[model samples]
Target: MIDAIKTFLVKIKDQGHVLPLIHQADIQVNLHCDQQIIQLNIKNGGILFLQNLDGQQVKYEISGSPTAMKQLFEGTERLRVLEQQGQLKASTPLRTTLLLESIFFLTKAQNS
Candidate 1:
Protein backbone atom coordinates (compact mmCIF):
# COMPACT_ATOMS: atom_id res chain seq x y z
CA MET A 1 0.00 0.00 0.00
CA ILE A 2 2.84 2.35 0.91
CA ASP A 3 4.54 1.49 -2.36
CA ALA A 4 1.36 2.30 -4.23
CA ILE A 5 1.18 5.68 -2.50
CA LYS A 6 4.80 6.37 -3.35
CA THR A 7 4.07 5.52 -6.96
CA PHE A 8 1.08 7.83 -6.93
CA LEU A 9 3.10 10.70 -5.50
CA VAL A 10 5.91 10.10 -7.94
CA LYS A 11 3.46 10.07 -10.81
CA ILE A 12 2.01 13.34 -9.61
CA LYS A 13 5.44 14.92 -9.31
CA ASP A 14 6.34 13.84 -12.79
CA GLN A 15 3.40 15.65 -14.21
CA GLY A 16 4.02 19.04 -15.87
CA HIS A 17 2.27 21.35 -13.43
CA VAL A 18 3.08 19.73 -10.11
CA LEU A 19 6.73 20.72 -9.96
CA PRO A 20 5.95 24.39 -9.61
CA LEU A 21 3.10 23.79 -7.23
CA ILE A 22 5.23 21.72 -4.85
CA HIS A 23 8.59 23.37 -5.44
CA GLN A 24 9.07 24.60 -1.90
CA ALA A 25 6.62 22.54 0.02
CA ASP A 26 8.03 21.11 3.20
CA ILE A 27 5.20 19.27 4.80
CA GLN A 28 4.63 16.12 6.80
CA VAL A 29 1.33 14.35 6.27
CA ASN A 30 0.12 11.35 8.24
CA LEU A 31 -2.20 8.91 6.50
CA HIS A 32 -4.04 6.30 8.52
CA CYS A 33 -5.73 3.36 6.85
CA ASP A 34 -7.02 0.41 8.82
CA GLN A 35 -4.34 -0.14 11.49
CA GLN A 36 -1.47 1.23 9.44
CA ILE A 37 -0.09 4.73 9.85
CA ILE A 38 2.61 6.36 7.80
CA GLN A 39 4.12 9.78 7.38
CA LEU A 40 4.65 11.30 3.96
CA ASN A 41 7.40 13.90 3.91
CA ILE A 42 7.04 16.41 1.12
CA LYS A 43 10.14 18.36 0.14
CA ASN A 44 12.11 19.28 -2.93
CA GLY A 45 9.08 18.65 -5.07
CA GLY A 46 8.99 15.00 -4.03
CA ILE A 47 7.54 12.78 -1.33
CA LEU A 48 9.27 10.38 1.01
CA PHE A 49 7.30 7.73 2.86
CA LEU A 50 8.31 7.13 6.44
CA GLN A 51 6.89 4.03 8.07
CA ASN A 52 8.10 4.97 11.53
CA LEU A 53 5.45 6.94 13.40
CA ASP A 54 7.50 7.05 16.61
CA GLY A 55 7.78 10.81 17.24
CA GLN A 56 6.72 12.51 14.05
CA GLN A 57 4.48 15.55 14.25
CA VAL A 58 2.12 15.28 11.33
CA LYS A 59 0.72 18.55 10.03
CA TYR A 60 -2.13 16.91 8.13
CA GLU A 61 -4.01 13.72 8.91
CA ILE A 62 -6.34 11.56 6.83
CA SER A 63 -7.94 8.44 8.21
CA GLY A 64 -10.23 5.87 6.66
CA SER A 65 -10.69 2.21 6.01
CA PRO A 66 -8.29 0.52 3.62
CA THR A 67 -10.96 0.02 0.99
CA ALA A 68 -11.90 3.68 1.06
CA MET A 69 -8.29 4.66 0.74
CA LYS A 70 -7.86 2.36 -2.24
CA GLN A 71 -10.90 3.86 -3.87
CA LEU A 72 -9.51 7.34 -3.31
CA PHE A 73 -6.13 6.50 -4.81
CA GLU A 74 -7.75 4.73 -7.70
CA GLY A 75 -9.71 7.89 -8.48
CA THR A 76 -13.01 6.15 -8.02
CA GLU A 77 -13.94 8.26 -5.00
CA ARG A 78 -13.27 11.80 -3.88
CA LEU A 79 -12.15 12.65 -0.39
CA ARG A 80 -14.93 15.16 0.08
CA VAL A 81 -17.52 12.59 -0.86
CA LEU A 82 -15.97 10.03 1.44
CA GLU A 83 -15.98 12.57 4.28
CA GLN A 84 -19.59 13.40 3.55
CA GLN A 85 -20.45 9.71 3.68
CA GLY A 86 -18.58 9.25 6.96
CA GLN A 87 -16.12 6.88 5.37
CA LEU A 88 -13.15 9.20 5.76
CA LYS A 89 -12.05 12.20 7.77
CA ALA A 90 -9.23 14.61 7.24
CA SER A 91 -7.62 17.13 9.54
CA THR A 92 -6.06 19.56 7.15
CA PRO A 93 -5.68 23.25 6.61
CA LEU A 94 -7.30 24.99 3.67
CA ARG A 95 -4.00 25.51 1.92
CA THR A 96 -3.15 21.85 2.29
CA THR A 97 -6.48 20.85 0.87
CA LEU A 98 -5.96 23.10 -2.11
CA LEU A 99 -2.51 21.74 -2.66
CA LEU A 100 -3.74 18.19 -2.53
CA GLU A 101 -6.63 18.91 -4.85
CA SER A 102 -4.19 20.19 -7.41
CA ILE A 103 -1.91 17.21 -6.97
CA PHE A 104 -4.70 14.70 -7.20
CA PHE A 105 -5.93 16.29 -10.39
CA LEU A 106 -3.06 14.58 -12.11
CA THR A 107 -4.26 11.20 -10.95
CA LYS A 108 -7.97 11.60 -11.62
CA ALA A 109 -9.34 9.16 -14.16
CA GLN A 110 -10.31 10.45 -17.57
CA ASN A 111 -13.61 9.63 -19.18
CA SER A 112 -13.43 8.56 -22.75
Candidate 2:
Protein backbone atom coordinates (compact mmCIF):
# COMPACT_ATOMS: atom_id res chain seq x y z
CA MET A 1 0.00 0.00 0.00
CA ILE A 2 2.80 2.39 0.82
CA ASP A 3 4.50 1.40 -2.41
CA ALA A 4 1.41 2.35 -4.36
CA ILE A 5 1.28 5.71 -2.63
CA LYS A 6 4.92 6.28 -3.42
CA THR A 7 4.31 5.42 -7.05
CA PHE A 8 1.50 7.93 -7.18
CA LEU A 9 3.67 10.61 -5.64
CA VAL A 10 6.47 9.83 -8.05
CA LYS A 11 4.15 10.27 -10.95
CA ILE A 12 3.15 13.65 -9.61
CA LYS A 13 6.76 14.61 -9.08
CA ASP A 14 7.54 13.75 -12.66
CA GLN A 15 5.00 16.20 -13.89
CA GLY A 16 6.36 19.49 -15.25
CA HIS A 17 3.88 21.63 -13.38
CA VAL A 18 4.13 19.72 -10.15
CA LEU A 19 7.86 20.27 -9.86
CA PRO A 20 7.47 23.94 -9.12
CA LEU A 21 4.68 23.43 -6.62
CA ILE A 22 6.51 20.71 -4.74
CA HIS A 23 9.97 22.24 -5.04
CA GLN A 24 8.89 25.01 -2.71
CA ALA A 25 6.93 22.66 -0.48
CA ASP A 26 8.51 21.17 2.58
CA ILE A 27 5.60 19.25 3.97
CA GLN A 28 5.07 16.15 6.10
CA VAL A 29 1.89 14.29 5.40
CA ASN A 30 0.44 11.24 7.06
CA LEU A 31 -1.94 8.92 5.33
CA HIS A 32 -3.99 6.99 7.83
CA CYS A 33 -5.61 3.88 6.50
CA ASP A 34 -7.49 2.04 9.19
CA GLN A 35 -4.90 0.91 11.73
CA GLN A 36 -1.95 1.60 9.46
CA ILE A 37 -0.24 4.94 9.17
CA ILE A 38 2.12 5.89 6.36
CA GLN A 39 4.19 9.04 6.61
CA LEU A 40 5.34 10.93 3.54
CA ASN A 41 7.88 13.69 3.50
CA ILE A 42 7.57 15.93 0.47
CA LYS A 43 10.47 18.29 -0.13
CA ASN A 44 12.46 19.63 -3.02
CA GLY A 45 10.20 17.95 -5.58
CA GLY A 46 10.66 14.49 -4.11
CA ILE A 47 8.74 12.18 -1.81
CA LEU A 48 10.21 10.06 0.93
CA PHE A 49 8.53 7.32 2.94
CA LEU A 50 9.28 7.70 6.62
CA GLN A 51 8.91 5.04 9.26
CA ASN A 52 8.33 7.82 11.76
CA LEU A 53 8.53 11.58 11.90
CA ASP A 54 10.83 11.54 14.95
CA GLY A 55 9.06 14.57 16.37
CA GLN A 56 9.02 16.41 13.07
CA GLN A 57 6.04 18.66 12.39
CA VAL A 58 3.28 17.43 10.14
CA LYS A 59 1.67 19.81 7.69
CA TYR A 60 -1.21 17.64 6.58
CA GLU A 61 -3.00 14.44 7.46
CA ILE A 62 -5.42 12.37 5.46
CA SER A 63 -7.42 9.50 6.90
CA GLY A 64 -9.65 6.94 5.24
CA SER A 65 -10.33 3.25 4.92
CA PRO A 66 -8.02 1.15 2.80
CA THR A 67 -10.60 0.80 0.08
CA ALA A 68 -11.14 4.52 -0.16
CA MET A 69 -7.40 5.15 -0.24
CA LYS A 70 -6.95 2.57 -2.97
CA GLN A 71 -9.63 4.23 -5.03
CA LEU A 72 -7.95 7.55 -4.57
CA PHE A 73 -4.54 6.25 -5.59
CA GLU A 74 -6.04 4.49 -8.59
CA GLY A 75 -7.70 7.74 -9.65
CA THR A 76 -11.07 6.03 -9.64
CA GLU A 77 -12.34 8.45 -6.99
CA ARG A 78 -11.87 12.15 -6.40
CA LEU A 79 -10.60 13.38 -3.07
CA ARG A 80 -13.32 15.99 -2.73
CA VAL A 81 -16.05 13.49 -3.53
CA LEU A 82 -14.73 11.02 -0.99
CA GLU A 83 -14.46 13.75 1.62
CA GLN A 84 -17.95 14.99 0.87
CA GLN A 85 -19.31 11.47 1.15
CA GLY A 86 -17.57 11.07 4.50
CA GLN A 87 -15.37 8.32 3.21
CA LEU A 88 -12.17 10.33 3.75
CA LYS A 89 -10.91 13.12 5.92
CA ALA A 90 -8.18 15.65 5.06
CA SER A 91 -6.73 18.04 7.57
CA THR A 92 -5.79 20.92 5.35
CA PRO A 93 -7.08 24.30 4.32
CA LEU A 94 -9.17 24.74 1.17
CA ARG A 95 -6.22 26.03 -0.85
CA THR A 96 -4.11 23.07 0.05
CA THR A 97 -6.95 20.66 -0.55
CA LEU A 98 -7.56 22.10 -3.98
CA LEU A 99 -3.87 21.91 -4.71
CA LEU A 100 -3.83 18.23 -3.83
CA GLU A 101 -6.92 17.60 -5.91
CA SER A 102 -5.36 19.37 -8.85
CA ILE A 103 -2.16 17.43 -8.56
CA PHE A 104 -4.06 14.15 -8.59
CA PHE A 105 -6.27 15.33 -11.39
CA LEU A 106 -3.25 16.33 -13.45
CA THR A 107 -1.61 12.98 -12.93
CA LYS A 108 -4.81 11.21 -14.01
CA ALA A 109 -4.99 13.41 -17.05
CA GLN A 110 -1.41 12.69 -18.00
CA ASN A 111 -2.06 8.98 -17.78
CA SER A 112 -5.08 9.30 -20.02
Among all windows of ten consecutive residues in candidate 1, which has the lowest summed lDDT? 103-112
Q: Give per-residue CA lDDT, model 1, range 1-112, as digits (tens).
A: 5655755765664466666877898877788987889886778877677886787776699898887776665556777778789988889887886676556555653221
lDDT of 2 by residue, 1-112 (tens): 6756766866765678756666766767788886777786767777677764455567798899887787677567788999999999999888777766666666653255
Question: lDDT for every model?
Answer: 0.72, 0.73
For model 1, the superposed segments whose C-alpha errors exceed 4 Å read 109-112
Candidate 1 — which pairs collide? none
Clashes of each: 0, 0
Worst 10 residues of 2 by lDDT: 103-112
| Candidate 2: C-alpha lDDT | 0.73
